[model samples]
Target chain A: MLSEPLIERLTETPLFAVGLTLAAYLLGMALFRRLKQPPWLPGILMAALLLAGFLAISGIHYTAYQDGAAWLSVLLGPATVALGMPLYQQLPRIRELWRPLAICLPISASLAAFYAVGIAKLMGASDHVMASLAAKSVTAPIAIGITEQLGGSVALLMGALLITGVAAIAFVSLVARVMKIRDERLIGFALGLNGHALGTVRAFEIGPTAGAFASLGMSLTGIFTALLLPLAWRLLGG
Target chain B: MAALSGFLWLISFWLIGEVVVYFTVLPVSSGVIGMLLLCITLALRGGVPESVACAAQPLIALLAMLIMPGVVGVFFIAGELVGQWTAILVGLVLGTLLSVVTTLWLMQRLMRGHHAE
Candidate 1:
């Protein structure tokens, strides 16, 4: 709503986009805390929605916004490399229950990719969307890496990551209870295995054991998928 | 300086991963390879370096924020994704439920000896 020249000048710079993103993220975090942090509504998801709505309303093109925000994505590489810390930290827990996790992880991770892609394929999602679908079960940082390798849409993968994460919480809570599968370890493992980081946080709320296993689930799933999905894509896609 | 060094450690591993990927043509994420390398290094060392922990933990925690922009790019592709929402949603919801249910069932059966514990 500024003078036309000023508006054009402001919109031309990357800072404008960066500022909006941070502002939205902070606002989302604040509102999330105020609302008591619902599992179905993560702060990042809220931030995403806020940013999307703003872009939609302001008539600002997403490419223009992306030009400025691309700087933030540069940090994703470092953040992904940082996952080693948690994997190392949770290694003991992984060792303790290595048997079940070793058995569950490959199947869970593979099934996650298989169903997501197969269903989306049935739905007639674009080839890009189907490609992105394969990595949603892994945490975002690593998932982004896989998405890039597959030449998939990072946006679609993020959406899938968030939905899978939230759905993991709901199903684990409802189904796990109904079936009398009460072990925090099992609950946490399922959460992380399917939900990634979001489910890991939820598992933490359950207990330390749950938290640790959730960490383990996400970390292992991430590493496994990151290493394997690209190869599988090449084999199958070729 | 310590935090900087920690970042240096992480970046260094990433570079190492890049180098490996460049050579091997492995079709895998270099950062993931780097992550595995670092994890293995930590395992061998039997402890996390303080600086690496300080740097990596916060970065790991803030990863979603860093990747936030790309996620919002969904808007950019709104046209492409316009009619595909139904498929994406159904796949996401069902795939997630199935994956979790499968994990819970498998873990319950495989870890049954510890069930009573």
Candidate 2:
């Protein structure tokens, strides 16, 4: 019923893109709840997929959507800064567990990167792709920079990172159950460090203290891995 | 004075991360390095200013949204991505599985240590 130009202009708006993303996220959330899957599964990745599909079906250029989605992107800076508040509130517990977390985060984060890269290589992926995939479990922005520096595809790395988050959301509970990990602090921290945002959400649901630790782990892991990955790459001649 | 210090702290954290990445052979980012530097500072200093913490809270809360622009940027390359869909799908699935298993295994070890202690 709409004119072609009208539809084009409508889709080009940032609000439309944000709306679509939010709708997809809500849909994913509904499906997750219905299927008894974890919140992160539907909340983030599904929203991404749905948006991807919408663009595909509509034959709309990604550049068009970019106009609308950039606003959402700007929020990332503030969101990252805001994470400090929650961590600040949990200072007492963080203080108590400082030594343990300090030791655990670096080791865990490094292994996660190593294993991801090793397996990707074993699966016969190209060397560049492997490099990009290495930092997928780290947060998105950091992963992008690392992927670019390693001479890998940023597109591939972003896809890998989102998938990593989804996988973490999907399997974290099962892993927790199988491993019999009881301490909320450790579970949440491990999740955040290795899983990033999705893992942080899971940690929050577990408990506020656990959520705080998860943020700590997520922030620390991102920082440490970012610093370490570049050095590791150069050492490997990447 | 406290607010000024907090702002300075944030900048220092960012710079430290950049320096580490620039100097190191690793494939990591300066921002991430900055985050680690901040964590260490917190650990050593005990805590940041309450006002600083408050200011940072809102930013962290929306951290995920900050990255959305990059994600949306993917739409611009959706054509290329679609062309490589099969490889991307394979990579995502396998990479995710590998991350989960490895993280869980490591977490279990950490949990075991916690329980033992």
Candidate 3:
């Protein structure tokens, strides 16, 4: 139970938390660049972790920062809408590969969800946690919704997504090498489908075409996973 | 005009998302659905509004930033998360590896036929 004054203080100025997060992200980006590691490694995850540490050290509760940080969350809607432009620009190529794009997008999304749930269950995760885990590959908001629908915790779903993005960034290139998968577009698409925004950013760095495909993959995965997870859940009796 | 166009584009994208989700039964966001919808529309319509494109660009640039807020929620629940960290970590790593491999394999098969075509 929190005191009234503490609750008010917690909710009062979320901007500070937002600012702290941005600063941490920028610092992490600079450090990752200086170290010549992958940019996504530090960008979001490091920022989140460092901020968490700082708040913990300062004895500021998580609720206090969230009050200020919710503003950043609101931007996700518009940012998602904004992805339309590059997708629009990539229309010609998309048309050229429409059949492949259409077929691969759903199949890849289904496999990603299935593998996540199956493996988690095998490892002995409970049904609800597995439901949240199933949406790990998609973007955050949609994944959160899917988590709720499947009777899982939204916070758990978010945590799972952040970790998934970080891991994809760290190992996707390695996996590509192992599989001998070479096409830039395919690599980008794979990363995006599995990694979400972090993978899409990596794809952009690889090349414009790769970025475009990755964006396409990310968007398609979000849609596909959201639509299919419930049906898959029922079939799995989850 | 920018606001109006942004709103219209948002609606268009949302409709596109709903239609795609409805037809394909894929659970995607309205924005991504909107992006795919816009892609097809541009292909058929053969162009896009310069203003619409212009308006959408900055928004995209701020995407990573946009997601920060939702992620910040983690800070609030850090204690609880720390307790269940192992399951979360395992789920993320294994899920990502599986998805990436699956996506790569599926795309490879899909693209194999494309090269043949």
Candidate 4:
């Protein structure tokens, strides 16, 4: 720990912001690996928790943190683009099984949206909450867009997205183990379809091939949800 | 130069995705659209270019970190979330489990014949 003046000066600089985030993430990664890679102990979640806790304790605003860390978010675009590597590698297999995937993927995507919104409604969630819940399985960007299109609260939508994503990460493996899912591709695809980005990352942990199929699941689900969600919203009376 | 080019390459496709979405009125995000276009490019080129791979690899490795800000933002709304925690949690857990289980079952059952072949 540095002296008070040095610490104060460091916190005021952009380097401090970026350094804090990276350091926390590295620490989380080390802890995750040392802990034998528990799903709930995912590095991203841990890093977020550590940083969020720090911010809360230090009284630093999220906006100030964002200013330094925006570069990381910008990389999400390229990282998403890089997902094509694994998807492309798996193309031959995808083509071979195109028929089943063509049918299965959309059905899964629609069911993901429907079940989420339906459960929320049954549990007496507000219409706005229902709308926000509509695209809960899709990746954040598309989910955020759909939520806005349906006039849902973005803040609440963000909360729901984080919850669904984190929960999917923690529980999807347990579901896979219980179901005896052995095919890495199937496991990855299921996670991607339901888990979104976090699911893809989890799939990467399983193997490169799993990561590939997971991206396929994630990307195709995004496409399907984007195309059908507005009509679905109208039908749901949102 | 390599990283900048890599970033440019990705951003170019992202821009293209945005344009296509605008013209077609698709609900998809620009990033996914860019991903699709890059997939096509890879298919045409016969492999992921080393430059693109190099540029994208670091970002991919650190992918998890990128989502932290959004998760942290959730804290800002902790008050509102507490009210609906039960419903939200139940909907997320049950819905995710049901969806993942059903899809896996369906995929396995549907693809069994293919696997046999």
TM-score of each: 0.94, 0.73, 0.82, 0.85
Cα RMSDs, all models: 1.9, 4.8, 4.1, 3.4
lDDT of 3 at B83: 41
Per residue, candidate 3 scores C-alpha lDDT tens digits across A1-238 of: 5565775675677766777878877876676677786554646666666777777676666766666777776566555666656666766777888998898888778877777777777766767677778888887756765776688777667777777877887677888899898899898888788888778888888898788888877877776776677777767677
Off by over 4 Å in 3: A1-11, A234-237, B1-45, B75-85
Q: What is the CAPRI rating of model 3's predicted complex?
A: acceptable
DockQ comparisons of all candidates to the true complex: 0.75, 0.32, 0.49, 0.60
TM-score of chain A of 3: 0.85
Clashes of 3: 9
| TM-score of model 1 (CA atoms) | 0.94
**Candidate 4 chain A weakest ten by summed lDDT:** A1-10
Model 1 C-alpha lDDT per residue in residues B4-112, reported as the tens digit of each score? 9999999999999999999998877878888889989999999989889878878877777887888788766767788889999999999888877888888998898
Clashing residue pairs, backbone N/CA/C < 3 A, model 4? none
**Colliding pairs, model 1:** none
TM-score of 4: 0.85
- At residue A207, candidate 4 shows an lDDT of 96
Top candidate, metric TM-score: 1
What local lDDT does model 1 show for residue A222? 91
lDDT of 2 by residue, B1-117 (tens): 565556556656666656675787445555555554555566677766665675565556545545554554555565654444555555556655565666567655655676688
lDDT by residue for model 2 (A50-102), tens: 66777767766666766677777644433333344455556677677666666
Taking the tens digit of each residue's C-alpha lDDT, what string does model 1 give over A148-223? 8899888878878888888888999998988898889889888888899899989999999899888888888998
Q: Could you give the interface RMSD of each candidate, to one decimal?
A: 1.4, 3.9, 3.0, 2.4
